[model samples]
Structure formats: structure tokens, C-alpha cells
Target chain A: MSEELKALDVAVEVDARGTACPGPLLEAKRAIADCPDGGVMCILSSDEGTIIDVQRWSKKMKHEYLGDYEDDGYWRVFMKKTA
Target chain B: MSEEKPNLEEMIKQLTARVDELEENAPGDNLSLGVISGDLDYTIATFIIALGAAAYDMQVDLFFTFWAIASLRDPKKKVKKDFLGKMFGAMLPASSKKLPLSKMQMMGMGPPMIRSVMKMHKAKSLEELMKEAAEFGVRIHVCTMSMDVMGIKKEELIDYPHMDFVGVGSFVDMFQNSKQCWFM
Candidate 1:
């Protein structure tokens, strides 16, 4: 947990690994709400589709996409809630 | 004699006016779904589409009629009914969770097998998709006439927020206003 926090500088971490497709994306959306304005949220997902989905969702929702990193069989995506 | 060049200012003004008029008269971007199948695959498909559209920022209206209304029933709720109605209710799956696949049911083993496979593949289950759809503000509507004909009471359905019990006319109005409509 500390490693992830250090790696992403995220205020909130959503563990959506093992969830499929829209599940991870939905979790990211929900987690972003808990983040303060301009605060970063990190989503950990194993689903391959989430990479593009989160990116698209971030763009559509006007969030700042901080990019993603692959770690230990999962992808960690970072986004800052702009709205 | 050479013809005079078209007036750029006048053409721009006319085009802008036409754009404004189209925007004013554009129908609401809504997706209306006529869900008429109670099979597990169909129910899952309905919710998947609804959730996908809702996530994409499109307003979604799902009208559950005929056999499809069975997918919204609460398994724990038991409604008293006449003998025939009781038999009918008993024959149908109690809730979305109990819905069987349209094909290869294999005496009810297929659904559980498929669900396990979905889980293994990290796919969202029907129940999970339904919850997501609700969170995304998808409007779920139950056909009142179908409920009455099937001897199902309001209490027998899951109490989703903003769920509506309406007649065919209400569904028609929604269909007419929707930019895209599907009967599945």
C-alpha cells in the first residue's frame, strides 16, 4: 500500500483487480468522487479493458489523466478529479 | 458575363440559423429499450446495453414487459395468487438471479456453470451490472398491465430507486422521445 501511494501520489486508492470491464471503470469513477478537487485517485485493475476505459472516462469527465503503470500483474491508473 | 461570387456573409448567417433551428428541434438523446425476454442471457444483455449507454452519458429507459418483468422480481417476496397464477409464478424463475439461459439450460446446470465461467474470466455478473445500471441513473419501468395479468404485486419486485410502474402509453411516449430505441 505504501509503495503504491508513493508511486502514484494518489489521495485515494481503489482496488478493482479481478473485476471486469465496466466494473473497474465504475469503481474508478466512484473513487474519484471521494478525492478532493484536484486530488489524485489511483485505480488498480487486472482487466485489460480498463486501461482504455479509464483513459476515455477521465477525458470525458474532464479529469486530469496522470497516466498508468503496470505493477505485479495489474495496471495502476492515476487521475486527478478536476471537477 | 461572369456571375458574381456568392455572398459569404449571407451564407454564414443562413447556415448558423439552420444550425440553431436543428438544435432546437432535436429530440432528446435517450435510449429506450423494450425488454421482453426473461432468459438469463437476454436479461444480462439488456442490462449490459443499458449500463453501457448510461455510462456513455445517454439517458436510458428500460420497459420490462411480459416475461421480462420476471427479471425484476424479488426472490424473497411471496405474493398470494389464484391456483393458476401460483402455477404460472412457480414455473417462472423467481428473480434475475434465478433466470436460466435461453439455450443449453441442461436442467438448470448451465446457468450456474456459465456464471462460474464469467467469474473466472472476471466478467461482471447480471446482478452487478443491474446495480451499476441503477447507479448510472438508468430508469427501469415495469409494465403495470403485465404485472396485473401475471398476478404480481409491487411488493414482489425489487425496490429500485426511481423505478416506475407504467402503462403502454407511457412507454410509447418515452419511445417517441428517444433518439434510439431497441426492442429485445
Candidate 2:
């Protein structure tokens, strides 16, 4: 929420809008995997099933899922990196 | 400090040489992953890609977008053709819906009928298969924007372990770091 907090953390953003099913989510996972410890990756999507799929994915990966958000007709998913 | 060690320097050199040998033979860390992004044009493609990646022991992620997101929908949707046609085409509607996607190998009736047969045989449904794949560590994602366009609700989706929702910009960032990216 605060810039200071953000400064102390690394973040990666993945844009998966209209990309297609599975393709985008798979990309997001690979991104999160490459991130350094204590980093977070955010994914943007336009798929309806993501609400369930991405949440389940983050859970399995043992990453922190910050829920989903809508931004100018796009979805924003924030994932915190862990190992 | 031993009173007198027998060839302490020689022993140290031998140990160091062995350590160096082990380090040289040890594998290094290099994790590579591939990503796919497409709609229905990607259903079969995504599955094949996942199977291959899983075989190679590479971590895979399938992010569903738009029509493709429906790929993760209820396997019941698999037999969809509306009430008019599907009713006549199906014997046991519920089982027909649970057939395996890959087993539906009919020429015109190939994929559909194979699914029907798989359903009759009590094969694992798409959701079940995807769940098992996730247990193997596959990550499946869906898009929220498509949800709005399709007028679908999240609660309608199945609860699976390898699923998630994200944004486009986020995917772009993912692309920057991925070893490989596929349009399927």
C-alpha cells in the first residue's frame, strides 16, 4: 500500500489479457519462479475462470495470493514470491 | 592441535581435490519454464504442451483467457450443443459430460463420442484431470476481464489447486523472464 513498503519489496507484473486460457497463467507461474525471494508478481488477465484457477495455482505454489482486482476492464492479480 | 599429524598438508590437498571433483560433477541450478497464451485455438495445444512439459520435469503454467477460460469450466459443458441437439446425441447426459477430452476421437463424432464413451467408462472428468495435473504442480490461470464479458461468476468454477486469475500487463512481465513463450 505504501511506497516505502513497496521499495523494500521486488515486484513483477504479468499481463495475460485476451491471451488465452492456460497460456497466461502458465506464464505467470514461470515469472514468479524466477523472482527473487521476498518479491511479488502481479498478473493481468481477461479470462473468466481465472478467479478460481489463479487462486488455486497460487495456493499450490505456496505463494501469497492478494486476490483479484479490476482495473479499466482488466483483472489484476498480485502474488507474493516465496521460494 | 595434534602432537604430530601424519602428512597433514598432503591430506588437506587430497580432501580439497576431492571437493573440487565433486563440485565439478555436481549439476548446476538452471530452471527453465515455458508459457502459453491463446483461446480455444489452444485447448488441445495446451494439453499437449502440458503433457510434454510434465514429461520433461519442467514446471508448466496454463493461463486461460476469454473463450479458453471456458476450458476449465464444468466438464458438463464439454457435451454442450444446447438442449436441442445434445439431448438426442446423449444417452446418459451426466456421464456424457464427464468424458475425457482426449478420448473423444470421432471423425465428426470423434472427440465428442470418445468423450461420451470415456464418460460411460467412468473416466476422470476434465476438472478431475486438471486437479491431478495441478497436484503434479501445473498452474492454471483464468482472466477476470473475460469473466465480465462472458457474464460468468467465479463461484460457478470448480475448486482446483492449480488455478488462478490475473491481468494482461502481469503476463507481459512474465514474458520478459520466461525461457520460452507459446501462442497456443
Candidate 3:
């Protein structure tokens, strides 16, 4: 999964590190508005809730949640704006 | 003989109609929030949940009553009021920024400490969350009866984009139509 995401073309990358709960998710929602449909978006977050929050947000918005990868102290959550 | 025996097609038709009715009666993608506390922590939590739900594509309504109404007061706006109204205004928190924390309030030290922590974590402040909530189309309803009891005038409230002065009955109607109800 990490290898797949690494090769995927991400149109937008939101850096939400050091933000608290729901902050990263909110950032992703705002950034995804500019991302074209079917474009992959990446969110870098250090919050612990980002992993599940992104997945749930993606599902609710009818987007495709590509999953997350841990790097150093932060995480990279990926999603496709299919909706 | 036909009158005595139940027809399969007719039974299926009846069941389908019943299912349709059930589906129509189910609650929709809406959330009703009862905000009764004026404490900074509770107020923040209320907006966080409301904003999150709004982002999830849910129609969100926040009904502010009693103490929570103080959080909506505009600090910069001054209005003519009776003695009682002035007293109430002086007693309650001036605005969201002036609200106290619910616990560990050591002579008003807790709020600032928590605020700094929030800033350090890059969490949106209460004002920012409220603005974002309005931007997300979250409806804010202030309780008419509570406002009357507290001697708060509509002009004294913040100029939120989607705010309205409403009665408890209106909130009840909203609550009944919502898929979920939260009391904070």
C-alpha cells in the first residue's frame, strides 16, 4: 500500500502537522475542494486521529480512501476525490 | 375461493408499500445540538462537533439557551438595557473570548493556559470554529425565552451569518426532524 501511494499522482498536499483532533480532517476537506475529481490528495498530519478520521470522511463524502503511511513523527493520509 | 385465499402479488404489494412508508418516516441527515453551557470548553466542543457534522454533509442546527447564550454576546456591541439587563450583562461572560473553563479554574488561570495549549497544537480557536461553522452553513438558533429571562437583546448578540432568534418549540421541531440530537 505504501508503494502504491508513493507512485500515485497527488494533486494537492495539505500539511496539517501539529494540529489537534479534526484539524487535519478539516484541512483535507478545504484542500480537496481545489483538487479535481478523481485526483488523489495527500494530507500530512501528526494527530493520532487522522488515520481513522480521513477514512471516515472519505467514505461519507463518497471518495476513495487510499490509506495512510507513517513517516518519522507524522503520517501521510491519501484519498481520491471520486465524489 | 379466491376471496378466502391470500394472493402473493397483493401481499408483496402491501409489504412494499409498508417498506416505503417506513423509509419515508426515518430521520434524515441532520443533527440538532442543545448548547446550554457557557463554559469555554463546552462551547468549543459544541462547535467542533457541529462543524464536523456539517463537514460530513449533515444539516446542523445549534440551539443556544440559558448560559450558552452569553457565549454569543458581542463584546464590542453595546445596547441600552434596564437595570436587570445591565446586571445580567455584567455578571455573565462578555463573549466567547471571555468565557471561563468548566474545571480547574484557578482564579481564571485555566482558560488562558488551555488557550495557549490549543494555540500550540494549532487547533482553531473558538472564534475561528464559530466562523467556520457559519461558513459551513451551520444554523445557529438562540432561545427566545432564555434571552428574555437573561434580558439579552438580539442586537447584543454576535452578527453570525445564519443566526436566528427562535423559541423552544422551533428547536423541538428541528430535533424531531434530525437524525441525531446532542445536549452539550
Candidate 4:
């Protein structure tokens, strides 16, 4: 799943590293608007909660949660805007 | 041909189904918040939950009452007042920036320490969160009774989009319409 996500073409990248709880989520929510419909977006966050927050937020917003991977003490969470 | 009378049983069943569908779809799209604390941490938590719920596209109504109204006071705006009003104004925090933490105050050191850490961690400050909340269309309702008791005038409040001075009954109306009601 991680490799598949890594290989997926992304339309937007939001870097929210070093932010506290909910900060990265807010940033991802704000940045998702820039991603074209059905396009994949990535959020890089150092906050551990961002992984689950992005997933839950995606579920609530009806977006598709692709997957997430850890790199250099940070997480890269991916989602696709689905109308 | 004579028109047949509508079947009472069938009509009742259809009406029941329609009401069920409407009830299912109507109640869960809004959240009502009762903010009664003036502490910085509580205020921040209130906004965090509010903004998060708003992100889900839920309608959010934050009713600020009692001490919470103190945080909404605008420092730059001054109003002439009676003795009691001036005393209340002088004693209360000037704005969101001046609020103290509820715990671990450590002789007035906690607020600044937490604010600095929040900045270092790239978290939104209270002012910034309030701004975002405004942008997200969150409704801010101030309790008129609390305002009157606190001697806070409408002119002294911050200028925010979608803000209103309302009574507790109005807040109860919002609460009744919301899927969840939070008291802070």
C-alpha cells in the first residue's frame, strides 16, 4: 500500500511538518481545495495525530483516503478529492 | 367514474415515511457550543472543536456567555461606562491575548509559555483560529444577559463576521436544532 501510494501521481502537496495537533489537519483541509476533483493530494506532517486525523477527516468529507508512509520522523498522508 | 376515496391506512404510512426521512436528514448537520469559561486553554479547545466540526461542513454555533465574553472584548475599542462597568472592564482580560490559562499558571508564566510553544510548533494562535473560524462561516453568538451583567457594551466587542448578541433562549433554540451540544 505504501509503495502504491508512493508511486501514485499527486496533484497537490501540503507540507504541515512541525505543527501541533489539528494544525496539519486544518492545513490539509485548506489545501484540499486546490486539488482537482478526483486528484490525489499529499500532506507531510510531523505530528503523529495527523495520520488518523487526515483519514477521519477524509472519511467525513467524503474524500478517499489513499494511504500514509513515514519518512525521516514525519508522515506523508495521501488522499484523493472525490467531489 | 366516481373518484375512490384515499385509503387512510396507506396515506398514514406514506406520511410517516416522509417524516422519518426528513427527521433523519435534518438534525445531525449542526453543532451548538456553549462557552462559559474565559481560560485560554478552554477557549482554544472550544475553537479547535468548532473549526474541526466546521471542516466536516457542519453548521457551528458558538454561544459565548459569562466569562467567555471577556475574551471577545476588543482591546483597541474603548467605551465610556459607569463605575461598575469600568471596574469590570478594568478587571477582565482586554482580549484573547490577555486571557490566563486555567491550570499551571505558575504565577502568570503559563500563558506566555504555552503561546510560545504553540508558535514554535506552528499551531494557530487564538487570534488566528478565531480568524479562520470567521472565514469558515462559524456563527458567534454572545449572551446578552452575560454582557449586561458584565457591563460589556456591544460597541466594545470585536468586529467579526456572523456575530450576534442573543439571549439564552436563542442559544437553546440552536441547541435543540443541533446534533451535539457542548458546554465549555
Candidate 5:
């Protein structure tokens, strides 16, 4: 299952590290949609509110909130449209 | 001095139709777009919508004249929502934070409360969105006369790479040669 998933996905890199909450999330949505469906969106934000905003917004928007990762100074959240 | 200027009539027409799309319904379908004149919440929404349109590949040229230029401040800094009721805590689902619509206008109390509620719910800030638009080639033009009239200096705005300082004549000429135009 993991192998099939990996084979049918695309990833977007959104560098919104210095921005405030909504900015990063919105950009992330944009970058994610620019790719094909079944693709993964990685939103990188440094704002204190990024995690919460993405978590809530993605779920509401119907995108699957995969998880969050920390690298260097930013937080990246991944989402994939499941429906 | 004016003699040294090249023929604008010919040059301006060439910039028509193809350089920038002018219609919102049809992305990348307008070379002449609307010029929004003020700085207010609705104005900000207009900017956001324009950016959204451009993100869809539309060519948009926004002229921020008068108070509209004031919105370029640090978006995360302050302000609350308008008549819209506010939301609280990040974990709270946005649906749970729906604005309570009022029927009999609650006097002037609505504005402040809206702001408080928005601050509480945490509406998305506009800074990063503006920056993203600039990166995607959405041209933001600031009016020089309005800046001077409002006592604002050029050095104050954020570092948006595509921002330009142009006058009304430029916008007029550009729009005159365009197929579609609007004023928000």
C-alpha cells in the first residue's frame, strides 16, 4: 500500500517560513493544487500559528492532514486529497 | 524634453490585449483590468481576490492609490474582523467559529466586537499572500501623488519585488488600450 501511494504522488515545496499564519497556509493550498490529484502538499511555515491553522483548514477543506515535520527553523505540514 | 519621448500611441496599443488579461471571469484573458481606489477591509478582499485570480494564471495590474496603500503594513500586526463574529483558539474548527449574523443592527457595537472576534479566531493574514502574488508576476502599482498627499514615504512598504510606483496617466493609457477594465 505504501509503495503504491509513493508511486502516485507529487510534492510541492512552499517556503513560507517568515510569514504569518494564513499566508503560509493559503500559499500551501495554491502550490498543492497546481499539481495533480493524489499529490502531497508540504507547507513550510515558521509562524507560531502554522500548525494549528493548517491542521484545521486542511481538515475542513477535505484534504488529508498527514502530519507535521520540523526541519531547521520551519514547520512543514503534509496533506493529500483523499476524496 | 517631451520631444525626446518616443511615440506612445503606437507603443501603448502594442501593450494591449496580450501583455495582461483584463477580465476576472476569464483568467489570462484581460490586458486592461480594474483599478481599486481605497484602503479598507473590502479593498483588501479585492486585493486577495485579484491575487487568487492571478494565481489561476490571470494577468492583473492593481493600482493602489490613496488610502489603499496603507494596507501594506505588517499584516500579522493587528486589527480584528468586521461585522463577522469572531472565532477562538486554533484547534476549534472554523465551522465552529461562524460569525453570528445580526438582524436588528446592534448599533456601533458590532465593529469593535467583530475585530475582537476576528483577533480571537485568527483570520489569515495578508502578508504572505501578497508576497506570493508578487512572486507570480502580479504587478502592484503604488500611486505617488496619493502617497505624498497622505504623508507616506516610499521606503515604508514591505520588500515586494514587483511593486511599481506609477501615476494615473499610466493606468489610464494602459486601460484605454485594454479590452476590459474595472474599478473596485
Candidate 6:
């Protein structure tokens, strides 16, 4: 999963490292909007809830969920805006 | 002759009709909130729930009555009022920004401390959540009777685009149509 994620060029980066549940997810939603269609967005979050929340939100919003990776006590989630 | 039993086709038709009838009577995908408390924590909790529900595509109706109406006031907008009204308004916080904690306020230190903690955690403030809720199309309804009794003018409240000054009956109608309702 990391290999596949590392290959995709990230069009936008949202640093939500200190944000808690729903905050990271909401920030990702707003950040994804700024990216062009089919563009990739990377979000960094310290909150554990963000991993599942972003996956669920991506599925519900019909976006492409590219998985996540943990580094330096935070998770970095990648998503592609399909719509 | 033996009495005839209903055939498979006839049973299927009856079942389909019953299903249609039930679907017609089902409540709408809406969450109705009765906001009765003006306490800071309670108000924050209310907006959090509303925002969460709205995020999931649920229509949210917030009915503000009595003290809860004070949470909608605009801190910068001052309106002339009678002696009792002025006293009541003065005692209450100007807006969601000035609301004090329900317990251990410590002479107004508690609110600022809590706000700093929220900031440290990167949680959205109550004011920001309220704005997001409005942007998400949550309908904010102010109680007409409460405004009359408290002598609060409509102009004193924040100018929310979708806000409606309504009566108890209107709120009841919305509640009846909601899939879930809460009184906070």
C-alpha cells in the first residue's frame, strides 16, 4: 500500500497533526475541494479516529481511498478526488 | 365445496400494498433538537451533534427557546429594551462566545481555560461549529413566544440566512416529521 501511495503525486497537503476526531476529516474534505478533479490530497493527523473516519468519508463521498501510513506518531492518509 | 384459500399471487399483492402503506407513513430523514439550556457546555454539545448529523446528510432543525435564545444574540448588536428586558439581557452572555461554564467557572477563568484547551486539541470552537451548521443547511428556528416574554428583538440576533422566527406549533410540526428528536 505504501509503495502504491508513494507513486501517486500529491497535489495538495493538509497538515492536521494536532486536530482531533472530525477535525482532521473536515479539513480533508475542504482541502480535497481545492484540488482539481482526479488530483491527490495527503492529510497528516495525530488523532487515531481519523484513520477510520477518513476512509468512511471517502467511501461515502465516492472518492478514491488510497490508504494510510504511520510515521512520527501520526498517520498520513491519501485520497484522490473522483468527483 | 371447500373454502378457497388465498392464492400466491393474491398474497403477494396484499403484502406489496402493506409495504407501500408503511413506507408512506415512515418519518423523514431529519433530526429535531430542542435547545432549552443556555449553559456553555450544553450549547456546545448541541451544535456538535447537529453538525455531525448534518454532515451525514440528515436534515437538522434546531428550536431555540427561553434561555437558549440568548446563545443566538449578536455580541456587537445592542438594542434598546425596557427595564426588565435590559436587566435580563445584561445578566445573560452576549453570545455563544461569552457563555460561561455551568460548573467551576472560577470568576470567568474557566471559559478561557477551556477555550485554550480546545484550541490545543485543534477542536472547532462553538462559534465555528454554529457557522458550519448554518452552511450545511441546518434550519435554526427561534421561538416567537420566548422572544416576546424575554423582550428580545429579532434584530438583536445574528443574521442567519436560514433562520426562522416560529411558534411552538411550527416546532411541533417539524418534530412530528423527524426520524429522531432530542430535548437538550
Error of 6 at A47 (Å): 48
Comparing 2 and 5 by DockQ, which wins?
2
Tell me the tens digit of each residue's lDDT in model 2 across B47-162. 65665667677666665555454445543334335454344324221222332343333433555665456579986544455555677776765656565545444554556676
lDDT for A56 (candidate 5): 54
Native contact fraction, candidates in order = 0.00, 0.23, 0.00, 0.00, 0.00, 0.00
CAPRI band of model 5? incorrect
Per-residue C-alpha lDDT of model 5 across residues B25-117, encoded as one tens digit per residue: 233343444444332344545557767767667676776665466655333333343232122212111211221223322563543466466
lDDT value, residue A29 of candidate 1: 64
Query: DockQ of each candidate's interface versus the true one?
Result: 0.01, 0.19, 0.01, 0.01, 0.01, 0.01
lDDT of 6 by residue, B1-184 (tens): 2344557668889999999877855678999999988878888899999989998899999989888999999988989999988988888778988888888789999988888899899988988988888899989988765776687888899988778765554565577768999987
- For all candidates in order, the CA lDDT equals 0.79, 0.56, 0.85, 0.86, 0.55, 0.82
Please give the ranking of all candidate structures by lDDT, highest first, separated by commas: 4, 3, 6, 1, 2, 5
| Backbone atom clashes (below 3 Å) for every candidate | 0, 51, 0, 0, 12, 0
Better of 2 and 4 by DockQ: 2
Docking class of 2: incorrect
Top candidate, metric DockQ: 2
Model 1, span A7-78: residue lDDT tens = 665688899987654567778767776899988888897754465556656665678877777789878878
| Candidate 1 lDDT | 0.79
Candidate 4 segments exceeding 4 Å error: A1-83, B1-5, B8-26
Candidates 3 and 5, the one with greater TM-score: 3
lDDT of 4 by residue, B118-170 (tens): 99999999999999999999999887657767889889999999987655545
Report the C-alpha lDDT of model 3 over A16-72, residue by residue, as the tens digit: 987654567778878999999999999998754467557756765689999889989
Per-residue C-alpha lDDT of model 4 across residues A1-83, encoded as one tens digit per residue: 88998899999999988665456777887898899999999999875546655665676578999999999988899999999
